[model samples]
Target chain A: MQSDNPTAAILVIGDEILSGRTREGNAHHLAQVLNATGFDLREIRVVSDDQDQIVAAVRALDGSLGGAFDLLFTSGGIGPTHDDITADAVAAAHGTTVVVDAGARALLQARCDRMGLELTPNRLRMARIPVGATLIDNAVSAAPGFSIGQTHVMAGVPEVFRGMVDWLIPKLPGGRPVQSLSVEVRRGESDVAEPLAELAREFSDLSLGSYPFHDERGWGTNLVVRGLDAARVAEAMHAVKQRLAL
Target chain B: MQSDNPTAAILVIGDEILSGRTREGNAHHLAQVLNATGFDLREIRVVSDDQDQIVAAVRALDGSLGGAFDLLFTSGGIGPTHDDITADAVAAAHGTTVVVDAGARALLQARCDRMGLELTPNRLRMARIPVGATLIDNAVSAAPGFSIGQTHVMAGVPEVFRGMVDWLIPKLPGGRPVQSLSVEVRRGESDVAEPLAELAREFSDLSLGSYPFHDERGWGTNLVVRGLDAARVAEAMHAVKQRLAL
Candidate 1:
């Protein structure tokens, strides 16, 4: 069956994330947003803030392997600092040049002027954009994100990234978002695998997942049924509830 | 200088994670543990539960690309269900076979016996291990994880994964753990990039990072210095503090 959902990939660039100095929250945030917006987030790669690694990841996600997504969202490493190398890496990936976008410069300038902030050369670094890209408005901060081809580059700050996502969602085409129904079962996943697998086979349209988690009491399973067809998903969830006697 | 730290990569396989039904906590937990155990976590990839993709990722992490790590830790997809294909994928990548290990079966049998549970066929599926593999004991759930050819496969359950990691850490050789110190300043990253970069260049042995975050008040930058030598790292942090006038 042909899938109508627009596929997307997320690339999180930072050394702090990889170093375990900071727990990553942006990927989870993006995944939820993409799912709500009807975009199939196929893959997520977290690479250090390195030029070569970022460039290679971008190219590979574009189509290097058998997998290629429609949209690519990259977060982090766009701030005004030496470690923020995402812009140059992205430009190198596209074989394009980085230039100061007039719109971005004006936005930066206006924010600086209003805040009584000096527009130092380092601060102006945020205005640099890859050639032939459109600016993604940052409502929280004046530093603008940019969209080149299918890739959208946004800030790593959750608030700024959220703002850019809210702005970009309406402009892109989306498919029917998948609706989900879940139920908690006290039994372990292995105890219910047979019946669950049978139900999964019965409802070929829906995606059934058995996730095992531990709480203060003991291990339990959460059965989730997801599909574009709400009725089918509901039907599967009902059948699962009956089979598990929940 | 020759580096003594063992490098590692984490591959997370699950549709729930990719679909945003679940937030990933195992990677962060593993990263902290690996760091504390003196291993360098170089890369992390989150792929859907696909057999070919899993096999390909295992191969690539072993040495296929120019980027090769000393160990590859995979979480999830090793369960008692049709979707549990990690064992087969790992065996395929290593040109080996998956068989029910006698020791693993004994472990499962003992747990089942103690819990007054029946050893169902589906539940027994957890005993299957790749050829020439060593079982990493799971103290929480009794389902043993395995290590085959530098690839360690464990359960997705955070509790189980953490238990297996704790069991595995002492068995592996460790290097000197990196020490880190951080200072937060109200100034923006751009305001400190020049001097910070200069300080970074002076301390060749240390890794200097400038992370920008927005709090309720306003934007601020956190300067972190990390190195193997405590004295050197402390020295670098002191210099950074002095350079930024913090």
Candidate 2:
């Protein structure tokens, strides 16, 4: 479906996720947030913590090679550890260098002082930012995320990622909020596929999706209609209900 | 760390996931299974149910453009609905055509007869397979998944996807299963970063990662050591614990 909404993609960088040690939550959280803010999320990619992989993914998503997204959000590999290489990878992708941002360093220094912890060089790694980037606020932790080019790099922790997204979404350029409505039918998806396809063709501007689920009540399909226009979304949902004789 | 294990990539095809309507579980499940079965999962990608995107991802993951994986597993978009276009996309990616397989048709026919349901055209869509592909058994449902080239296409349902993986993993070639050990230290990640980096450099064959978490007990780091050799992994973990004084 074509959308006037700005497009976005999420790049999740971590070995813990690739090894199945950590279930991914940041991408899903950002997806919902971006959807509500009316950005068309086109893709979500999970790559290892390897710098080359991170650079390739960031460049690909940022549209350096082809169709580019208006915004790219990355999670993971921004921690105060040896494996935290996102800042360097993102800088490499942008053809820039990583530098210590005074604002980020001050925040880290203040946080260390408040917690009675030494601001060691390892902890200072979090202060590094790509050149020509602005710091993104992190209310939970003082180590701020940063916006470099079209990409916003954030921490992988679920709480910190959510806080970064919450703090950053309001400042982004957004279109009209997307309106989504759904109707649950007890019939099989194939039983309604023909009519649903017809409805989808009729409302080409809206996105209609059929998701199957099985519960104690038995098999069912959730028919969802989403669009930037509230009335159009509601009208399409009503048609779905009527066509299915709900 | 370099290994002899066959590399693999997972492509998740669905708008539901990109829209945040469904939390991704299949990729994580597949990762753990592949890890245990001795496959190196290099990447996991989630793209909307767009034919062009699916074809491009399939080509890229299959290494038609560059470095190829030994196997590519795709989940979702195989249902009996209009949006279920994975089979067609995969066929196009291979420069082939989608045709109904006799074995698949027989399975679907038996399922319909047993369930006392009509074998409608939409239902028959599940029987269509890419030419020159073999069926991957799905114990949960009669609708069989297919493996074309190095790519195995499976259902989106968690139960069915797991069943397909169980049936397919043993049939594929694998190397030594990866051995992983972890030590949870009550110290912050920055406090342990320097020693961990030294250990990582010392044991260049093993992967050492430090993941930080915060709970009621306060902040701590989980030092994970992973490698193909059990002895090496154990040795790395020992070094990490000793270095961190855990």
Candidate 3:
């Protein structure tokens, strides 16, 4: 089905990210992955470990996809800690209970044996999943993530979460191919602002941006040309640099 | 005034971030900032340029604070692009029209002139403020951010956003003093897991975490002790390390 609009959203769950205890780099990493696989990054949110907040965020993001968002990615709060409530919330949002799936339990048990840790009552919480959800393997850690409907829920730990996301995205159906082009210049965004606006209008299919950065030579701009087509981005980038005379 | 529950949330707005073009580190930076300042981070979200999403996110986050949060900080969407709709949505949330406030105008004009940009109709859009709001000055960038009610809106760029958040938060009354202690041992999280959990239970007021990282013996754990009181954290860390015989 060739849909006119294809988008994706990321719901980051945890009190840590919300409180700024951990600076998140996953959103950017996921954004790159989704862009390459062809999904319009529509929205990204960080909600705490509150079940109600997670449910609200998940439901809202799922609804926004309008059946066109090929996928919705959620990161964090899937651990054994008290604050880790994403798994339960995911089940509740889809009107299900947290059940210990057979495969998930097997993975956890193997990891626990390898690590020589007791699989306590709270640790069992890691095996819980929503009904009819498929497990996403976490090679780096014992806990596994899952995908129910179009929502892909994963871990909060950056390396594990990104590992799952990278492995799982390719197996699903990708709707569009994300594309980008960039040219760095030694001029303020405002200096070449007028031409940038015109170029954006000229290449309406491409989303153009003028990012100004400082590197000793006063200020410069990194003009990025993004779109679905490679040729269009290249054309726009060339035009932008020529117009700006950089 | 000191409050019982110091609440906080982050509202990240941008298409670049949502689409995965730009990686967002602001959420994590802000989280660490709030934790160090002793504010309880409740929720964080990244919405796109869509007006409805922004308006809904702000209203919900505003309601969540309920005069309990020390502050609600936001980053991104304070630009002069067509997709920049945060100002308008913020005004909608507050029951006001997006108007050019005098203070905002002066700041905007000064920035535009400093950056050598002509204050055009489009450029002036960055100056549009929700009525009765205070401006957060951007030392790195000319575009000044704003604060309405408790939501502190700043730029999306990590450096600029972090600078603005640092300026805005310390101005408010910080509720709790943060405390932390660390001990690195030549063992994996598994080797010292039991003792760490036992110690965490003993100190109800503190949070103990074991982060496994690179070590000369292959893998090592960085035992972290966090709490509101410095004395308790110190005592707990000392006991935990001794008990584990590390």
Which prediction has the highest TM-score against the true structure? 2
Q: Put down candidate 3 lDDT per residue, B40-105, tens digits, no spaces.
A: 777777776678988877877775435324467777777665556788888787777878877767
Worst 10 contiguous positions by lDDT, candidate 3 chain A = A62-71
Best by lDDT: 2
Per-residue lDDT of candidate 2, residues A1-246 (tens digit) = 658988899999999988988999899988899889889998999999899989888888986435357789999888888789999999999989999899999999999999898888999999999999999996787888999888999998777888899999999999877789988889878899999999999999999999987667767889999888888899999899999899
Worst 10 residues of 2 chain A by lDDT: A62-71
By DockQ, the best candidate is: 2
RMSD of each: 1.8, 1.4, 4.0
Sorted by lDDT (best first), the order is: 2, 1, 3
Instruction: Give interface RMSD, per candidate.
Output: 1.0, 0.9, 3.5
Give the higher-DockQ candidate: 1 or 2. Answer: 2
| For model 2 chain B, the run of ten residues with the poorest summed lDDT | B62-71
- DockQ of each model against the real complex? 0.78, 0.80, 0.43
Model 3 CA deviation exceeding 4 Å by range: A1-5, A63-70, A80-83, A108-125, B1-5, B64-70, B107-125, B183-202, B205-223, B242-245
Cα displacement (Å) at residue B10, model 2: 0.4
TM-score of 1: 0.96
lDDT string, candidate 2, B6-38, tens digits: 899999999999988889999999999989889
Native contacts recovered, each model: 0.71, 0.74, 0.54
